[model samples]
Target chain A: MERTPVLRSEWLKIRTLRSLPGALLALFAATVAFSALAGVSEASDPGFDPLFASLSGVIPGQIAAVSFGAMAVSSEFHQGALRLSLAAVPRRGRWFAAKAAVIAAPALLVGLGAALAALLAARAGLGRAAGGLSTGEQVRGVVGCGLYLMLMALFAAGIAALLRSGVATLSLLVPFILVVSFVIGDATGTLADFLPDKAGQLVLRETYDGTLGPWSGLAVTALWTAAALLAGAWRLCRRDA
Target chain B: MTSIDVRDLTKEFGGRRAVDRLTFRVHPGRVTGFLGPNGAGKSTTMRLVLGLDRPTAGSATIGGRPYPALREPLRHVGALLDAQAAHGSRTARDHLRVLAASNRIPDRRVDEVLQETGLASVARRRVRTYSLGMRQRLGIAAALLGDPEVVMLDEPSNGLDPEGIVWIRTLLRRLAGEGRTVLVSSHLMNETASFADHLVVLGRGRLLADTPVRDFIHARVRPRVRIRTTDPVALTSVLARHGHDAQEHADGHWTVDGARLDDIGRVACAAGLPLLELAAEEGTLEQAYFDLTGAETEFTAQHQEA
Candidate 1:
């Protein structure tokens, strides 16, 4: 039928689910809490950017965003929920699109709120130290961080669809985002910038020496999310529920 | 008008064929029992019909269109593949709401089904806390959210208590009485016999019999007469002479297969044998089903007599 009804149904599912909303709350808490901590601390490094530092909490907080996306899709795989979902919607593509849309909408909304709160919390501590920041730079950092978190959540969601297991998606992603992205960046300079997480996080920086611009970095991450989602949809159409 | 039509439907997993060229039609206004032993592909066939699984060959349709091709399919066919399919953390009300919203069904219908299934009292509780029977009621509620013309349930009575079983039986009968195409699958022949007017028997992923329930029983099982006599010796010898082999039971009653009650009475009267009781023994669905699928059972135990 019409896609609107299916999208509404998916939104209801997310609202009713405690864990899905809980993940968003955790995202907000982690981003604000970490950014506030960063704001209170003084960094001696000459290269530190105050705007980036204010939103740096997202580095760890993005994990919650990834979880929100993964768990939302993975719940369908548990206890034959996918069968019920498919039976209700029947059109596999329509149902999946609705699911992805619901995931992206909430992630982006919460990401934006978290980014704004973190910036405000951290700026309180930076005081004169953050005076060099312009309104445009601060706005970009906040907005970009929000979009960055949403992309990460969608990226995790796409991978979750392909694997059809939330735990597997989390296991692969949690470590890669936590360890490999950093280690690889230190070992291989520009190449690590191409990875989905590293590329997307570039938006949160006020100044960057990377080849990609803020929006272009986010675009690279979007491409990765799209590829993962395409793979997921292919598997959904090809495999029996 | 919405009937399930499955034609030459086939599904294979890996090298093993789960459903083999199965063909059957369940008409509106009747309860068609999809009967088979475990691993007989009853579930697989249902999955194919619902478009939950793709058919390796052939097609299944409802109202002249494939399941996925139908817009707002839940309003055309409501199915309960697994009673536990609802997410455990969501309340029963929310679970039905999700399905209702998907089909653009009114929210009032969700409460109606919950009340119909006697789950309204527990509608606010999380499904994880529900007993199996309660979960089954919730599943039924979800299925009826759209008030679809065709209702399909697989092994719905598995975890229900006797009262719950009776409830489902009445519900299925009422659904069929309302002219809906009702398809219910169960491994137990006797259970299906209670509510099913038509039988679609399957064995080893193949159609065994598709006929009226009464005809299915009468055509497969031999009609027999049970005779209780004061003089067993005389009755036996007389029937033996008349070309009827009488088998004696432990209950002191003699049974003569392929013999009518009237024929037995005549022989007893002509021979002047005292007949305490002479009646046609009722053929049970269990016996008829066993006779039909006995050979098709995947794992058959040695006969008790053997």
Candidate 2:
């Protein structure tokens, strides 16, 4: 079979995988649930930006995205899966490319839907405050948040493939996103804005004072993802199954 | 045709050689048993053949080309390196379908193999829920889904019941009888003796013997004529004068080689000795195998029993 069958098989692997699809579902649920909570909660500070508040659910939702990416590849590391996979598609490049595509496509689709859900749910709770957000900002925020989550997911997948362990990837990333990015991100000031998660999240805000602009920040995040993906491809090509 | 060939194939992990300059050819239309003790490079050699591991030196090819060169390798060879290598969460049917889809095998072939392997009843159940025997069947089902010309299995009989073992023994014979090359690896002597047409015996990453099973048994096993007599001392002296080395054990049985049972009985009769029992000990593949590999193995039958 040509590349089509490999891709189809990988798609089937992802779809049938209970944990991976479960992770995607968790992504949708977590993001929407958090955004709904953000909408209902009263903002204590005067610096409350409704746009950021509406999309705040992305903070927790992106964990599921990263998990999805990492788990998709990490599953191969368990139960001698890589051996069986390589037996079917002997060419390593073909198998790795197909796996990456399977991970990216679903993540992007679900990311968009989750982003839309977060905005709608959060907007309902912040009705009057969300009124001031322009149409262009909402569109940018939605599209950017979707793309941002997808990038984070792809980044995690590349890392997972290189390490061949989802546990390692999640352990490193989950804390970095939730803890290190805030505590260390504050201490580092402008330099911290270029970090993959930090830089990519810039578009989530309606107004930004970061060193990099929204598209440029996304470009930086994409560059990080590209670098990670190349490293993953290299590892996949060189390592034994 | 040499459907599966390993030419001076060598693999080393860190500083230790896992497979050392192994060379063998498995021809089509026969089942070659890959026999070895634990850690004797059986799995490593199979991995090299399938390109799951890079050989440190030399080459392993299937149908005359390295595995990576095949556009879709499954169409040429199907391998099951491990029975439980599959994800536990996927159903048996889904597992076969995933492999089938990768090879462009028809969806119907999935069901066919499931039925053939007797897994149709639990096709929808998760693989984790299946017993070890069921997993082996599922692995065999995946290997057969592509309808490949060559099937290579490692320890396929490990978890099988008597009926399942019989099923696989027949399946292997039928597969080879259909002109496909079937290479099965197992350490069990009697199990392979039942169905293997040829034997490739390995020990400590080296080939110990490679020949037709019957030929190996004939060449390595020593057939003996056992004699039990009332007057053992008289018979022993008579056999010794007849140029036969008859050794009498403490159990009062005399074993003699290089002569027929008739000749031994004639010698006893010539000595006016009454024989209580006279018989010939037939050589078995297990006996032959141990005689061939006893020194090369780290442990012996005594060790295994202990």
- Supply DockQ values for each candidate: 0.81, 0.79
Model 2, position B130: C-alpha lDDT score: 85
Candidate 2 to truth, TM: 0.95
Best by DockQ: 1
Chain A TM-score, each candidate: 0.98, 0.96
Q: What lDDT does the true structure give each of the candidates?
A: 0.91, 0.88
Q: Give the per-residue lDDT digits (tens) of candidate 1, residues B101-144.
A: 98999889998999999998999999999998898888888878
- Native contacts present in each candidate (fraction): 0.93, 0.89
Per-residue lDDT tens digits of candidate 1, residues A94-114? 889999999999999999999
Rate residue A24 of model 2 by lDDT.
91
Distance from true location, Cα of A167 in model 2, Å: 2.2
| Number of the predicted model whose TM-score against the real structure is largest | 2
- In model 1, what is the error at residue A29, expressed in angstroms? 0.6
CAPRI verdict (incorrect, acceptable, medium, high) for model 1: high
